[model samples]
Structures are given as structure tokens and as C-alpha cells.
Target: MKRLFAVMLIILLAGSMVFAGGKKESGTIKIAVAGPHSGDLASYGLPTVKAAEIMVEKINAEGGLLGRQVELVIEDDVCKPEVATNTAAKIVGEGVVAVIGHICSGATKAAMGIYNDSKILAISPSATNPALTQSGDYPNFFRTIASDDAQARIEVDFALDTLGLTKIAVLHDKGDYGKGLAEFAQKFLEADSRAEVVLFEGVTPGAVDYTAVINKIKNSGADGIIFGGYHPEASKIVSQMKKRAMDIPFISDDGVKDNTFIKVAGDYAEGVYASGPMDTTTNPLTIQATKEHQEKYGEDPGAFYLNAYAALQAVFNAIEVAGSTDYDAVTNALRTSYVETTLGKIKFDSKGDAEGVGFSMYQVQNGVYVELK
Candidate 1:
């Protein structure tokens, strides 16, 4: 009887150990989706959340990664740097294997150190600041979008060569993203002898009125303007410019390329030139993604929707290919493997920028952004 009791105790201990191990190993894999899911920039972040949901559904239906159901740890930073740090900490605490957001550059930059220290891989769909990848500080960071320098080149070239604008005013919202792109534009314009930067200035964002800055641009005799900021300020500046009867070609960066800019600025949005990612709507993957989004969400996907979808797709693919969620393993797979995304067949370069992704010029015509041919 003593021997039998001892044997039973040993078996019970082994069973408990096995059950605990199984519970740990069989739990769902968590991927975080962080961005501005509320506030004025909600248009930029909610699409990513929806994309993750759709991707999670599709991935689970297709057996998920590593035979584990994929889960999303969605958090909103509202595109604020202070909020992004807290969001990053929350995501880390949540035990996510990877991250897919912090859509704005300032927010992404703020969160990157935390993710780097935690050894979690992050892929941004629209954090276009060049330093995020080029600075050599965050090896675990990758992105599905072109950087601001590249977009700046596109905007500068379009202004100089295409639009034949010589004297240009370069204005920014003084935030990290806006200032970074504006600086790049200023550099490019200064380098080219064909054009001159008539004015380089920063405006406080969320200001109720910008007529004072508009008057500055008018007084500078700028033939065109390169406004580096998002849609809200862009809409306000452009509306004020139009109200003052100043046309002079309001050229800006991808920050102003979103549809919300048009919706907010209304008729003033017309003729505004902005540079954004090259249109990949012709790709079959893009078509399918759009269809899925429309069917499920009852509306067109918002800004950076496909890019966010592609970011999540790349993360999942890397995990599957590495066959483990180890930080180095997944990041290695991401660098070495090619994943077919809405952007088409692509992979990350050493600098974490996506291969084959680039910017294109667009003009707001007939209340829609028409890609310039």
C-alpha cells in the first residue's frame, strides 16, 4: 500500500507538469496592432485594426501560424509620442510576439526603443521617417512603406521638373514626421539649382487659424508650397490659402494625401498636389484585400489600409517560415524571405524599407486623388 501511494503521487505530479506545459505551448500567439485608433487621426489607425481582424480571421481559417490561433493585442496611441510609450509598454506586458503599428512617425519613434529592448519585432505600415531604419539603432524594426526622404525626392522632383515651380515655400507642422519630411524637401530643393526654397518655416499644429502663415507664403513670392504635415493641418492651411485667393499650387507630402484631407477641406482640396505611395490597386492581392474589407466592413478601407494588411501578412509569414517566434529567427526570416503582399512580391532591405515600394505624385481633382501619370 505504501509503494502504491508513492507511485500515484509521482504520476499526479507528472500529469500536472504535462498539463501546464501543454497550456503554455498551446496558447494563442499574440500580435499587437498599435496606432491612433481614436482622436482626429482615427482614420489612419482603424483600418489597421480592421485589417488585423480580417487577417486574423483568414489566418485562423487557414490553420493559423504554427498550428496556434493568432490573436491581436490592439491598442491606440492617438498618434501622440507620450501615449505611444505607454502603449508600447502595454503591448510588451501583453506578451505579444510581434507588433504592426504606431502609424505616425513620432509615435513609432517613441515606441521603438521599448520594442528593441524587449526584442520584439515591429513592422510599420506608414512610419516613413528615414531615421527609423537608417539610424542603425533598431535592427528589429521594419516597414512596408517608403521613407520620407524618398517621398521628399518625389515631391521635389514633381515640383521642379513636372510642375515647373521654381520658388517654393517649405512649411511644416514642427512635429517629428512633418519636420523630417519638410527638412528633406528643403534639402532636395536647395540642392537643385533649378529651384529655390523661398521660405522654410514651421507652423504650430491645431492652430485655429493659419492666415498669418498664409500671408508669409504670399509675401515670400513662392510659386508653390510644400507643406509637410497630416491632413487636418493641411486642410486648414489649404482652406485658408484658398480663402485668401492664393492658389500658387499647394504641393505637400503623403501626410496630406489621405482622403480625409479632401473631405475636410472640401472644394479647397482641389488642385492640391501631394506625394504618396505608388498605387498598387491593379495588383490581384490588392483587389482581393479590398473586396474582403468592403464585404466585411461595409466601406472602403482607409489610409494605409493595404500597407497595414501587408505588414501583418509579412509578420505572420516570417513566423511561419522561421517555425518559431524567437525574435532573431522571425526577423531573419523577414529579411531573407520574400512575401507576396498587397504591394506585390517584396521583401525588406537592410535598412528596413520595403523593396519596390515608392512614391507617386497625385492631384486632388474632382474631389478624388488622381495619380499623376
Candidate 2:
């Protein structure tokens, strides 16, 4: 009887030790990385995931935050708003300290309500629709990239003052970012600038042919065309225009600025101009990081990935300043913190938006994106 009691006590103590060890391991500082990991837009999402992975690795290697290794919990929102909301809820349920994604503006907007309700701090690296920051309810939401309004203002200046374009046609994909940017540009061009939007229309995203739209623009007698959409749709439109012998200069927002656009559009991408915050290729740090990324991953990093890296840095900086994993504390710290990231110094305004940054214009030459003056 004595031996049996001793053995039972030993078993109970061993079980208690196992449970305690599990609890300690589970005390990880989890940062959720949500994006369209599996979709036609996977190129955009995958790079963000890779960037977050790199950031986590770097953070962990340096003894991590608050003496605990950072852990990344990535979720695929598939670039859909509903999926994004669900993913945000799941991340919150998993007790992640913060979130760094839902790359598309629509997805970010969808998840905003949940994040706000849950008091989870979410910083988007790529979502650029003006509404996300301007919306009054999203106090916990933040974005690293400049808004479409800024991009539009810069592109409009280039179109009128630099390119000397008088008449232009604006086309958009009808997505949140696309339509927001197109409408914003149109308003600015018509009201503030000498440029006239001769033709404005929405195109169905993922359509293989845009011959009808191209013909409309051709007949509209516009000297230039601005497309507000991603590379896939923009490439198809440009390629189709080439088939129709449309020689009008093509301009686009950052959505269409990617190497994949050049590859898909082939020679047609040459002379295509795009406006965004300076391309990652132009930044020395980004250039070196791209080389390292290529060496490690066998491919160059995408534009959004660099933005994600900056966003992650901002979040971690806020975490360190707050000195605790509490979401509200970190959120407050983010608003008050001055973080120097890959994009330079970042300071947020009351609206949770970056301040006083300008956009850079780039043009494709010989299948490579080069910054244009």
C-alpha cells in the first residue's frame, strides 16, 4: 500500500511538470500575419507572409520581445473581405498580441470592425484605399503605405505638369482600391488640374479581353490612359490594347507596378508608367535585402513585402516601447512612437495614418521597373 501511494504521488508530480512546461511553451508572443495566401493574387500575399517570416526570424534571433521569442501565426484570407473578417476573429481567439495584414484595402476594411471590437492592433502594409484610415470607427487600424489620395495627387501632378497630358481616360477594376483611386484621380484632375478625363469606366476584373474598352478609349481621343488595378488585369488590358494597335501612353497606380506585370504584358509593358511610394528597388536597404531574399528564397521580393517589413518593424517597436503585450497599451504606444523603418522615419497622426510622405513615379524599361523623374 505504501509503495502504491508513493508511485501515484510520483505520477501526479510528473504530470504536473508536463502541464507546467506546456504552459510555458504556450506563453509565446503570437503575432498574426493574415493575407491572401491562396488566390490569383497570391503573389501579393505570399511576399507579405515571407516578409513577416523574415521579420519574426530576425526578432527572435535578437532575443525577441520582452524576453520571449516571437511567433507568427499566418492565416490566408484569400483577399476576400469575409474571409478576412473570419481570419481576424480566429487570430483574436488565438490570443495573438497584434496583427499585421489583410493586404488588400477591401480585406482590411472587412476586418476593421472585428479588430476594433476586439481591441486588436492591426497595421496594414499594403492596403491604400483612403477610407480605411478615414473611417471613424477603426481606431486600432493603421497603414504604412500612403493613401490613394496621395498617390493620385502625385500622379496627377506628373500627368499634367510633367507628362503634359491634356486628355486622359481612367479605367478601374471596381475593387475598393481601384475605384477609390480612379474616382479620386478623376475628381482631382477635373477640379484642380488642367487635365481632362475624357473617358471613365470600370472593367470587370479577371476578364481576358478588354477590346471593347480599348476601342472606347481609342474613339474617345484620349492622349493617355490610367488604369487603377493590379498587374494581372492591367497586363491583360495593355496586351489587348497592343493587339488593337493603341499607342496611347499607359499610366497606372501602384497596383499595376510589379515585375509580373512586365512578364505578363511582355514588350507592351515598356513605357508604361506607374506612381507609388518609391519602388523597393530604389532604396539601398531594400536593394540589399532583395539580394539577400533572392539568395535565400531564389526570387526577388515584391513591393508589398518591403512595406510589410516596415509595418512589422513599426509594430515591434511599439511593443518594445509599451513594454507589455497588452493590445491597448501597444496601440497607444504606436500612436505616440517615432519608428525608423526601411521606409524612413514613421510617425502616425491622430487618424492612425502616416504623415507627409510623397509618392514616386516609375516607368518600365526593357522589362525592368526604373524610377522616372
Candidate 3:
């Protein structure tokens, strides 16, 4: 009788172990969508949150990944590097396995070191600074959007080949994202030898007026100007140009992709050209996602939305591939996995940048941004 009791006890203990392991499995996953949710760049942040929310809802409807209900905790970093560092600390402390952003490049770079040391994954939708991924300092960091290096190439090609505009003036906000893009433009622009970088300057981001900068552009005899900054300042520069009756081709990078640029620049926006992330409208998944966004949010998704949603999906794919929430496992799985998201089939290289990069050019036509082929 004593022998029989021992066998039963062993069986009970084995079953309990399996049960406990099952309970601790990938269930109730939580992700922090960190960005400038409430600041001057709020326009960019709102769509990122909305896209994540929409994707989360769809994942839940499909019974969630790993039979778990996913929850998104919105963490606002306000696009400031100092605030981003603090927010990153908070996110790590809160036990999140992944983060979707800190949209601006400076913010992402500030927060990435913490995530790297902790082995937490971060996939940025819009942070395009090449160093963020190129330097290999943050193994856990990845971005859905193309780096500014690719963007600079696109802008230069258009300036030299398409428009044949050679005399160029470049201005930056002196922030990580802006200054990096501006210097990159100048480098490639001068390297080609076909184009002349007439002026390279930095402007204060929140200054009320850009009259002084406008005078510089005018005096530089630059037929075209490339502003490497967010839309708010880019709009001001263009508007000031319009005030001076300067109808030159003012080209900018993805920072000016939002409709806010058009609204702020008013009629002057007519000729302004901005290069944005890939136009994913051709993809069936993107079309469905955009429809769902409108149905759920009562509005259309922004230029950055598809990439944000894909970032979240990439994280989820990693979790599923790892078959658990182990950070190291997911990180390894992400590097090897090819994810077909709204952006189409995308895979990350060793430095965590997308395998290929693409961008779409936009021109303000009739006070609205129209995609230019």
C-alpha cells in the first residue's frame, strides 16, 4: 500500500509541473507603444497609437497570439531625447517585452541603449536615423521605415535626374534626425559633382519666424532648397519663401509627410515636394488595413501607420516563432524570420534594418498631398 501511494504522489507532482508551465506560457502579452503622443509632433504619434490599437483588436479577434489577449500601454515620450530616456526606463521597469516607438530618431537613439542592455525588443515605425541601426550598438532595435540614407539618395536622384535642379541649399533643425539627413544630402549631393550644395545651415526648431533663414536661401542663389526637419518648421520656411514670392522647388524628407505641412504652408504648399515612406496602397493587406482603420478610427491612416502596424506585427511574429515570451528567444527568432506584413514581405538584416528600402514622392496639389510617380 505504501508503494502504491508513492506512485500516485509522483504522478500528481508531474501533472502540477506541466500545469504551472502552461500557465506561464505566452499569455496576456503587453506591449508599450511609446512615442511623442502629446507634443508638437502629436500628429505623428496619434496615428502610430491608432494603428497599433487597430492591429491589436484584429489580433484579439483572431483569438490573440499564443491564446493570449494582448494589451497595449501607451507611453508618451513627447519626442524629446531626455524624456525618451526616462520613458524607456519606465517601460523597462513596467515589464514590457517590446516597444513600438519613440518616433523621432533622437528619442529612439536615447531610449535604445536601455532596451539593448535589458534585451528588450524595439521596432520603430518612423525613426529614420541611419546610425540608430547602422552603428550596431543596439542589437534589439529595429525600424520598419527606411533609414535617412535611403531617403537622401532618393531626394538627390530626383533633384539631379528628374528636376535637373543643381544649385541646392540644405537646412536642418540641428536635431539628430534633421542634422543627419541634411549632412547626408550635402555629402551625396557634393559627391556626385553634377550638383552644387550652395548652402548648408541649421535653424532653431521652435522659432516663431524664419525670415532670417529665408533671406539666407534667397541670397545663396539656390534654385532649390532641401529642409531636413519636421513639418512645422519646414512649413514655416516654405511659407516665408512664399511671402518673398519665392516659388522654388522646396524638397524635404519624411519628417514633412503629414498633412500638417500642407495646412501650415497654405497655398505655398502647391509646389513643395516631400519624400515619404513607401506607398503601400498597392498591397492587398495595406488596403484592408486602411479600410479597417477608417472603420474603427473614423479616419484614414497616416503615411506612417502601415509601418507602425507592421512593427507590432513583427514583434508578435517573433513571439509566436519563439513559442514563448522569452526576450532572447524572440530577439533571435526576429533576426531569422521573414515577416509578410502590410508592407509586404520584409526581413531584417544583422543591424535590424529592413532588407530593402523604398520611398514615395509627394507634391502638394490643390492644397492636398498628391502622390507623384
lDDT assessment of candidate 1: 0.91
Give the 10-residue window scoring lowest on summed lDDT in candidate 2: 277-286
TM-score of each prediction:
0.64, 0.63, 0.63
Can you write out model 1's per-residue Cα lDDT over 1-373, one digit (the tens) per residue? Answer: 9999999999999998897566536888999999999899999999999999999999999998899999889999999999999999999988789999879999999999999999998999999888999998999899998876998888888998888999999999999888988999999988899989999999998887998999999999999999888999999998888888888898888788999999999999999999887888799999999999999999999999999989988999999999988788899999989999999888888878888678879999999999997
After TM-score superposition, the amount by which residue 205's alpha carbon in candidate 2 deviates from its true location, in angstroms, is 18
True-structure RMSD, every candidate: 7.8, 9.2, 7.7
lDDT order of candidates, top first:
1, 3, 2
lDDT string, candidate 2, 1-373, tens digits: 9999999999999998898566445567889999888879888888888888888887899998888889889999999998888898899877777888878989999998898887788888888877788776788888888876987777777888888999999999999888988888898889966778999999998776788888899899999987887898898888888888888888898888888889889999998999866644456666665665787689878758777887888899988998887777788888888887777677677777875345788999888888886
Cα lDDT computed for each candidate against the true fold? 0.91, 0.83, 0.86
lDDT of 3 at 172: 94
lDDT of 3: 0.86
lDDT by residue (tens digit), candidate 3, 95-175: 677899979999999999998887789999999888898898998898888887887878888889888998999999999
Predicted model with the maximum TM-score: 1
Question: With candidate 1 superimposed using the best TM-score fit, by how many Å does residue 298's alpha carbon deviate from the native?
Answer: 1.1
Model 3 RMSD in angstroms: 7.7
